[model samples]
Target chain A: MALWKNGAFVDDAWREIAEGEDPPPAGHVILPLDWWEQERDAFEGSNAPLGLRVAPGVPIERFARDINRFALIELVFPKFGDGRAFSMARLLRERHGFRGELRATGDVLIDQIQMMARCGFDTFQISDATTERLLRERGAPAYKRFYQPGATPEAPVDSRPWARRPG
Target chain B: MYRYDEFDAAFVADRVSAFRDQVSRRLSGDMTEEQFRPHRLMNGLYLQLHAYMLRVAVPYGTLNARQMHKLAHIARVYDKGFGHFTTRQNIQYNWPALSDVPAILDELASVEMHAIQTSGNCIRNVTADHFAGAAADEIEDPRPYAEILRQWSSIHPEFTFLPRKFKIAVNGADWDRAAIQVHDIGYQIVRNEAGEVGFAVYVGGGLGRTPMIARKLRDFLPKADLLAYTQAIVRVYNLEGRRDNKYKARIKILVHEKGVDPMREAVEAEFAAASREFISLPASEIARIKSYFAPPALQARAACDAYEARRQTDPRFAAFAANNVHPHRVAGHGVVTISLKPIGGVPGDATAAQMDAVADLAARYGHDEIRVSHEQNLVLPHVALDDLPAIYDELAANGLATANAGLISDIIACPGLDYCALATARSIPIAQRISERFGEGERARDIGELKIKISGCINACGHHHVGHIGILGLERKGVETYQITLGGSGDETCSLGTLTGPGFSSEEVVDAIERIVNVYMSVRTDRSEDFLAAYRRVGMQPFKEALYETSKGADI
Candidate 1:
């Protein structure tokens, strides 16, 4: 329930996978998506990693190895009160090596897109907003090769596009 | 005085612009008080007892005439008619508005001055001997190292938010004037047998609620490792110092809790990793910085028959000359400390007019060097001996010739409760009363070499813990009370003062201090055995008895 999905809370009620078998959401561990708050066993089983995200403090202490065990870290902005989330995503991409789809979910105003992109958040999902096109324009200028301190050195400029994005 | 070179000017300008942007953002609601607090404080704006107080770093307590004028202008433009000089040798304007701070910073930047690192948990202003270059007993001047430290610690990324506020002081004098041991890190410059300059580094020394004298970490640190070694100490402090308990968070506590050996070993390990790094001061760089502090030109002169004749007739001049002035290393020159404690005036305070007058005197009579001493007095370091009579005349005319340098009247007191929010009790009033009480005595010389330091709280900004007779202002049951401590010394071997018995009311504190001094005079073998020396020989019992004579209740 902590993870917002499809513009609302993704109901965590478990659904039966097979007859006489356990539920779907039942075994899915819940996490706040903040880097520090994400638990170790959230994705312990043969399943996709639960998101881990949040803002980082000054001088960003958390490194790539710190979050490397996890498969994905999604930066969550609870409210505009937090700034550590932007820095967290930046550190995750450039420093901590979090390369999975970096998503921005909460408190996603149209204003913070460029800086967020510069810091390495690729995809931003606003919870509810009428002007999606305007927001897209704001998010239009995502990247022209990253200049952040901890970015992957070998990107489109160094590696061919086919090799760079395996997906 | 170090001129504003292009580099210095550019850095100050950048800081000013940054502060201006910060102010604009704060005004536009882009930053909250929590976010803006550190930024504002780093730029020297403090939300104090009433308003924002801006403390301008007077590096090594040296200021040129132009800078003094700028300070005076700051007083006129942004504040009341006066600015208060702090115990740390910086000047603070108590009434600058939050809006004008950026503009005030711009004005300061015009003169190669900025309030960067004046506050916050970073290394505060690096102070050195006020008489760094011109003192009689001199090694290499410590100001270059101080300046280097100033540059390195200015907005330093690693050690900005440490366990607590850090202070560093360097001293080259045999007689410690800068209160070196009371700093977080104190370095004394020394030349080894090979005639190469190095430092005797002391760490974990500071004054707070739990006052402690620093301990030596290394016997000798090569001059090259000055910056790296400093960084190492700070890095070790940042990594290991406790942040849970604010009071027990200074480097002194870490050194105390872990013991000096373990803490020192930790620092050395970090230092070994940081050793021979790019931050090391190159020989050429050292000499280049040293060149900025070269001694001013001195012209030869004969011993003054003019001053001799003036002294023959004027007993006042004779007293001022004999007791107040210090001998200079240069021939036919004397270093004069112009007392700001003019009976009722606040210590270390100069009205705008008074500041202009001092600036005028420095330009006309003395060399272009002026020193703001730790005792809250100003020193004209090099005045020709022949000009002594004229200098005394000018000083007397300006009401600065208070013929009391180390006398009981020369009491050192901080801004206390009046101006500083951190103060527990008022210090200025007590200082004024003490100066007034001792003002009537014709026997000023009898109260020889006494140091009465009072701090409002245990922060020891006034350095009360280091005084020969220390008065600490503490609040008792909603009453402003002062506790008396004895035998506190701030020289090369610094020691924290021990409080004797209970506290006294503000009204009775002056009389108690007098009684303590009277007891010293009565028991001393001779006048040469000053209060400190006498107290060293015969401990605090006599002084305690003297304080207990009139009041029967304090369990003497």
Candidate 2:
């Protein structure tokens, strides 16, 4: 497994705790949604950075109030075709105003990285080594001209009022 | 008729290069078939039963002579020397090798065309009335708005992965030539009491396993809010449409389940929240696109005496002039429909030579503009009446002169089991057989505007649900069978056809159609009443009784 952040592969410091496992004492750690729901008080004032891994079918609104408390949010894809996480990412960034690191994990592919990036996923955890290498080398072969305005505030460069302005 | 600017050109080039890379990765085993299927489909490449089928979009059914010529060239070079014009205003090559797809796309890009979003769950090609600018009754041309939609929907990031494919159609006339009511989103251009242009929007109409007629969502939406309103509807559908089952994933299903009122409320809420600065089109941009679709300047001329004399003398020319020519907004011009459904031939297939000849004819007399109708025919939308004789002669020589534009022989059919993996039975052969049964020119003219649409399966790709005589083909007990429906129409007064009786075998289906036609002819009050008119006047009882009794060996 490789973790890509801010345009390059980097070390993954966060340890994702399995079910029924004790929380780590020192370093940053991520807890599954169910475990975090059951044990919300244990990580109230920890020094290490707190992260949450939100899976599909877990109502994102349940964590709306506490979204600012976490430093990182890992949105799981489960499969590339199941795109519930993409919507979740947009909601977290646009609606909830989560200014923390938004990461995409599980079954992320090279072809989908551009769209994932547009949906506000700043970091990606890819299990496939070949896809990781491709992303590291070419950085998602995407069109520079876009048609839709996404979570980002930048206007499309081809059409509309913003494009007509003098540089 | 909108030509691509530099931005549009570079955008299409970028898409082609990206698809080229995707194809290379698929061939090199970097991506599995499961992963590559959606990507290729987004590029309009489908793995059909025999080979890869490529559907090239003709935006809003408009094309120029150069584009048509390039299509003919592609057919000659990469395909099987022929192409099938589809009901979605696209041309599909039934036999293209996967390896040659990139080259084919490169060829298309030369002519300012690409197959983006032609088959994916994203917004497909935005279709409009075939006779948009040339129609005598049009309030305004819908192509400019359709072009705006084409640009907006192309490569939309959030909408590319929708639950199911989405279709939008626009019509600028009161007669509904574009079949607007049966699309996912139907926009009918209208003028308010104060003489301001806007749109009457309809939502949720579709045909598949579950057929539905769209309901009016808004009586009038201002023209400036077109893109913003549409974006809101799509956003709501993307967030709420069911993804558990592919069959029930269309926005029509979601609209049906949620009811129209709730759906409208949700869409309105989304529309209210959408940022106007990001979604609304500027007036300058609208004017820029509208300038491209302005009708060509013409020197008005009187009716040609020579053409009238020829029509009076030549029976074949008279028949063609009667059925194939449509009224044009310009006085001396007419819209000529080039029938792809020649008697006993495939419904929409045209050879490369035929395509080239049509292009030549269009360049000579039709202002270099062509259109592909949803009925699977081509149109020279701006042909001068004086040049009809020469155009007809060239079309006759090239096997493109079938004078059955709205007659019984102009049947609509899907590429069924013969080509499509989703079809249960063959539809093209059935259409061919029906056309042959009523091949007589006089009888076809007398039958008068009978639209027989056929679909091979429940998907209703051929729009069988809205045909005057709809045919559904299914396999029953190791044999192909067809069920008939009556009195369906895809017009302003749209209605789903009713099933007449039990299914019939392929061999018996044509004769059954003959019996139904005979019943209509006998019971019709006068010659002026067409088949659909008579069917609507008298309900389905007489036709149903006649069909079942004829099957039981009853006398006329």
Model 1 steric clash pairs: A33-A53, A34-A53, A35-A53, A55-A84, A55-A85, A56-A84, A64-A96, A94-A150, A94-A151
In model 2, the Cα lDDT at residue B449 comes to 82
Q: How high is the DockQ of candidate 1?
A: 0.06
For model 2, the docking class works out as acceptable
- Return the top candidate by lDDT: 2
RMSD to truth, every model: 8.4, 2.6
Residue-level error in angstroms, candidate 2, position A19: 2.1
- Model 1, B386-456: lDDT tens per residue? 88888888888888888888888888998899988898899999999988888724765876888889999
- Count of clashing residue pairs in every prediction: 9, 0
Local error of candidate 1 at residue B410 (angstroms): 1.3
What are the Cα lDDT values of the candidates? 0.73, 0.87
Q: After superposition, how far is residue B523 of candidate 2 from its true place, in Å?
A: 2.2
Clashing pairs in 2: none
